[model samples]
Target chain A: MTDPSRLALVPFVSVADMMRLVHHIGLETVLTELAAEIEADFRRWESFDKTPRVASHSDVGVIELMPTSDGSFYGFKYVNGHPKNMKEGLQTVTAFGLLADVSTGYPVLLSEMTILTALRTAATSAMAAKHLAPKNATTLAIIGNGAQSEFQALAFKAVNGITEVRLYDIDRSATEKCARNLAGKGLTVVPCRSAEEAIEGAQIITTCTADKQYATILSDNMVGRGVHINAIGGDCPGKTELARAILDRSDIFVEYPPQTRVEGEIQQLDADHPVKELWQVITGAVPGRADADAITLFDGVGFAIEDFSALRYVHGRLRDSGHFLELDMIADPDEPRDLFGMLMRAG
Target chain B: MTDPSRLALVPFVSVADMMRLVHHIGLETVLTELAAEIEADFRRWESFDKTPRVASHSDVGVIELMPTSDGSFYGFKYVNGHPKNMKEGLQTVTAFGLLADVSTGYPVLLSEMTILTALRTAATSAMAAKHLAPKNATTLAIIGNGAQSEFQALAFKAVNGITEVRLYDIDRSATEKCARNLAGKGLTVVPCRSAEEAIEGAQIITTCTADKQYATILSDNMVGRGVHINAIGGDCPGKTELARAILDRSDIFVEYPPQTRVEGEIQQLDADHPVKELWQVITGAVPGRADADAITLFDGVGFAIEDFSALRYVHGRLRDSGHFLELDMIADPDEPRDLFGMLMRAG
Candidate 1:
């Protein structure tokens, strides 16, 4: 138990705790709720203060801090992307995040965002698909059956009523692993031999292959009209999934232009390329899925507010469940100015 | 005990653990070591990647993220300053930090930085005083005897061999509190009735008052020749301690001019006011303290590398001491790309 008098205790949700929380709430239910929370926050986009993530790049990988605030709460995620880590039995991406009271600037929650980031990223993609995908879209072609594959499959089904999923990865074992995981999830799961087979009869195609270069997972000829392409793999500079001609044919929508221009599939286009903002689309200020034949691409690079929403959702659920631990992260003195005295007395 | 797996488990220095670590090592020794560590990092300033801290300001206070890297290691501190917090029995400034291996992009340590930040700030001030203060200076007048007063008093003794301290605050109880804490510390401790009396014979006037606005704790006429003014409290924008005329009279040195111009005492000076970089002085690339009659001022705003050095020092100490807890912060799976599979199997 932590002392109540001191402000040292912060509630922390570990990865194990996160898995338990998801099961307790039902994974599909969690995804559906997260999508709703993200949509709600997006509607109030004007209220948020956003900035491009602050990154430190090295020869091997990059570490970034993504922060945002909405007058009452402040949140940030500490995430790293090291594509080569997977070779050493380490995750290519790992993350954690914190949410604090804007009034006090004291963290209320510390959470492992590795699992949560995949969840929220999928949630954001599903939320965008709900607005931009064809009205009766049911099949999802998930190209790249890696860490993010199953979540993307589940989230699309939960939020957008996706009933069929075709999977493809360069590694056959990856495709089989994703298929095995989705066996009893009430979806028509297909393990495709190639990318061409994955997109057959699929109105929604999500490409999430883990590559650190500008390799085209989907060329222009593969994409048909009126399909929603959720490109999730190409999220860093020099890393992209779609060819330039495919992006040219699709009506691009983005989370934040300044960020997407540098990181998303839109990086292939000119800086001045006209793309619709996702938040504006959510708020009904702009059109989505225009005229049913224009290929709408949610050039989703992900954003800070989506993570904020996910954290807020998880924090709200912690009280009903007991999967969190108290962390002694802050220093509170009997007399706030007697910091040295606190140390002296501790001695 | 924590489960040791392929996943990296960052050792966390909790507030209680930090207190124990300080007692185990002795606070004076910690201060002395921190000063040396800060000085060593300062000498290699050109090799460091420095940025003006990213700040998020609210009506109540400000929260900042300070990050620095030296090729092999990356470190960042999340800190908040809310003056109104003191009225509610909370420390005005609270902080936490993380250090990660740059090669792997994995956090190696997580620490409660409230105590460490105080230690580093004082060590930095004492480090600056070591070069800028008049040689053989013995007495220090600590204006605003609050949370930082005792540490400032001890750091000077540890780093620069100060033999006496005179304390003053608007609240006489604060002055009494500081003097009581310093009792029998092998130094002469004096509790003064006013700021003027506090600086009577002191050669170093350390102003560390906690005020949110531009209010002078030390006026122009109060300053004397050859005294090194360690102006600390004037850190954030609009909060200053020394009068403008005093800034003009003293030769000022700062950390990161881009940041100092916005947050330090030099904020009141001209946009291009000439000031010596502390790193240059420490590296012997620039001269420090022109002469005995010339007043030299260390306009310390604190820097990221100082916190990085403090964290590095603590990380080195953790291996030798048992005052740390392993945090299950990272999610590691046997299959690096099987995040969802791990969750599914956790059931």
Candidate 2:
């Protein structure tokens, strides 16, 4: 009967809009800025309320809700992981998220997180690497040339001054895809034929392959001393990429232990195994890369706080970018308690 | 960019769309249909994956995520309870929910739940009343005339056999507002000054006041034999409306025991107190309203399954109503692993 209230309109960033935003801001700048936002949130980790993602596991895949709040803003992501989906012309992981004002419980931004998750996951890895990688790391090896490979390459380049990227995947076409995408992106993109060749002369190694069950994309023999490993694919129970021997040799740093122990590559180890918490490292409570001679691993199973930070960052830029649609997502009656009156008036 | 894949566009029902759909199908029929949908889901309660909503409590309010799955479909509602928000010209509760194909982990429908929540809450209470209220009940008393008042009146009239409606509130203007809104809704609407006067000849009393702290809207002596008390507002800890003495006198039936113990009026009762689960009553596993003289109280602290059912109901009608908008909420690259290429192509 009347025009929808402005309070009811939530800003929604679609997948294409997210792409445009990244292009407008420059993906490298977005990555660098996202990493900074993530690092800031990590420094004040004590202020956040964390929980292991609530997952609904089915035979074919799993759908999960990752929610976190930092008093001022609240955010959550709906993500689904189905490794076999790629064969059906579907993504193995698809996501969307909402950022709401904690004070009023009204959604401020709703974004398609399938692209954003890739960006945040890469930024988080790059942030951890900045803390735990060897001094002046220059070259990176990406062992899985899948959906996340290019973003990881760019993030490392943007944040850590990496000059070269070496790529490898079980599927050669995937490696070509990654290599083709990285062409002319201001880095030496080397497409390697084997995982061993991919890691050759690289200081940082990132393994992100999609296989629902345990599969070693990186073995212990290949990982040398002083190299930082950003293991991303080993998220979700029973899905891991690094061999336990590789894990045993590396000084493991994790996002959230409770979640990492169940969903990260560290799920391969004993529950009580000693590992460094990355947030503590960022906050200076714990040492990162104590010595250059030891291998370090950042077991990054994506966390909700990263999504919160990503949403907060997007919400900040949405005002000027105009790359979003206003969604009629909330119910706002002229009188808060007159919802029925509003409904009756609709006729 | 190529046109968004059909799979990427999720149907979103806004508040206006929901009201239009409700009016399209008579409100009474929607209530009756929603009640049946809720009743059917309750009958097969074990089919759903259940968990108490994950809540983030702050100094001012609480934001929660209610998630559930019935094996085939997954649903979750992002709801915030901020009583202070109403004073700021915002709804005390504003919500939106998503229903996804659990098989693929992709969202199919997104609907504004603030209005839908009122519809479903009322339908759920009325459904329980149909099974637990005294036979030939006609008069209904609604205490705390707020956003939910008119829905309760109509739901009871549609689901159960109710004719006359009596309303009362601490603020008499709320009562007047509710009565005025129900003007031609096919019932005798009576606005009373006190809660006591409102329940004068009513067999069913619905108390739904919004208070962050415990306060008695209905005392012990006010409740008598053979009356069913639908306590809907004592949904969060410390926000109750009924006296402890009143809870002690009734056969308390609840949606879920663990949740009710923390959020329902039974929070005032012992942890080990024997209370009937509403699902059990609906499934005939437990008896409801054992006799006319036995007082029955439905401690309805809305649950995830009810939201799941409501989402399912809206999704079923979305195609025919054509009142929903399609938003590109998922990434659909031709090659699932070529997400980076999709972004580059968009540029």
Candidate 3:
């Protein structure tokens, strides 16, 4: 069999490679850079070909393909969400993504997106908080300290200048795990016993529970007037973290309304309820935090553009990090019309 | 860093591995088995989740994601079609696919689909012909002999008992390449100067061209009684191979009506144009090939179910074949909620 040409090879970053890349660039820097990339993409969001994620739902879970293109490049992520996976000692969400040149439709980069998704999700939240959170917000209350909690805490610390994180989860061990993971990470990690206790003196409250139903992680009265709410867990149709009353009290901002209305916490409200697009806020076309006394909500459902940004960012880092393997993924026969001949030669 | 667990590793079949596996299984046997698998899936078609491919179109080409699931397993293929790429010495289409567990929402296999797509497409065309073609059919005339022509010829020989293939292409060199590839493949290869001469004594006419715009490769007068038409190239909007008059004269069958109406040769007809689903015919709900003299047309805009069948078949052959690489594409921590801890330990 003949060796594949260079054009047929696609750079692939496995989980270990992604971890190495993250460490090589430093987590804080990665988070901050990812935030910057995402923000930059959001600034010119109209140039993108955006669509609501295409999701296939089964009885147990859902698998989705999130695809978006920005004229020059195309990107998509294959992600599955199964909340019951936790009990099976598996991640509730696992993903992989690809970036390709739009002109030729050839994949240039393929990366394990489980770690990248977590990073991008946190980075997006922190980026939004930078625009919506009250000034000098130093403390963050993270409700549901699970797999995503520490990343959220660290991202907020890096991007939004949060110096302390108060963690709480229904499962006590999860809180302890998050706290332990965040130890000596340049932030004060406080393990709180109750949801109210976690939000005691924090200006930003992040709800990231892993329930698959409409369970209210936070209620109307529990939320104060001057706090920024980062709702991340309420990502699918029947799953939401905040109560409808809490949504009514906050000025909600979302990634993409067509998608958020179907999958985010905004699903709890009326279909026509007014909400701001986060990109508009970033581009200075829409106001973020209206007043110091107003409640601000960033309902992030994790859009395709953020994943696109993350993959593009990783593709750029491949040159310096050298933490990728090239897989002979595309079949580039010497003669474009002789694919069968190529196979015959291999035989 | 600790080695990734078994759950994190996904088996990836590169183009070389796929080629070797195909040669190991024998190309003819692979085509026959793939046809049988696709036919079996077609028989139980209603049990699967079906959606038209999600396409992202650019000025030069298009990238598409085709996804489907059958309760137990979910599969998706990422493919691109760029007719202009041929001018730059690139294949018109390249693809990769993934199969995942529906229950856990985790990828089980990742295989290079560029070659597999060519194989599956040919297998599907031949499988459809097996049902719709006249009994004792022996000759296939393939128009626009490009990368797909040789595979079509071989698949017909393996699955439908075709003994001769007449090939024609606007570019005579493409026809020469195809004729050379199909040499000694247990079939008579005839290279023709015109589409008319190619179908002279052939029982089946396979139109597989690469032009992106609407251009009639076969007209009403070129088609005759009792011949089955396997329309393969008019797969996108504004790109068709057969004349509308020919479609009106034949008994048209389609894989998925909602999709074929928008992307097949039948797109030239009315929205309410009557067409039979190939699965219905395979399951015996609808009859195929009404009479010996009646022309039967299979307007196949390749569907997701066929790719699912192909991926499922490849996945089943992995155990003994062992023609795959284990990729650490999933982040499987010992504790499901300790992903951050896993990354920190990697550091």
Question: What DockQ results do all the predictions give, each relative to the true complex?
Answer: 0.79, 0.89, 0.93
- Pick out the ten consecutive residues of candidate 2 chain A with the lowest summed lDDT: A214-223
lDDT of 3 by residue, A321-342 (tens): 9999999999999988888889
- Please give the clash total of every predicted structure, in order: 0, 0, 0
Q: Which stretches of candidate 3 lie over 4 Å from their true place?
A: none
- Superposed by TM-score, candidate 2 places the C-alpha of residue A165 at a distance from the truth, in angstroms, of 1.4
- Per DockQ, the best of the predicted structures is 3
Per-residue lDDT for B154 in model 2?
94
Candidate 2 vs 3: which has more DockQ: 3
Residue range A1-347, candidate 1, lDDT tens digits? 23535477999998888888998999999999999999999999999989988888888888988999998999999999999998888998999999999999899999999999999999999999999999989999999999999999999999999999999999999999999989999999999999999999999999998878899899889999878999989988888999999988898999988999999998888899999999999999999888678898988877999999999999999998789989989898888899898888888
Candidate 1 residue lDDT tens string, B6-52: 46578999988898899999999999999999999999998888889
Residues forming the 10-long window of minimal summed lDDT in candidate 2 chain B:
B240-249
**lDDT, model 2, position B296:** 96
Model 3 Cα lDDT, one tens digit per residue, B1-347: 88999999999999999999998999999999999999999999999999999999999999999999999999999999999999899989999999999999999999999999999999999999999999999999999888888889989999999999999999999889888888887899999999999999999999999999999999889999999999999999999999889999999999999999999998999999899999999988999999999999999889999999999999999987999999999999999999999999999
lDDT of 2 at B344: 94
TM-score-superior candidate, 1 or 2: 2
Scanning candidate 1 chain A in windows of ten residues, the lowest lDDT window is A1-10
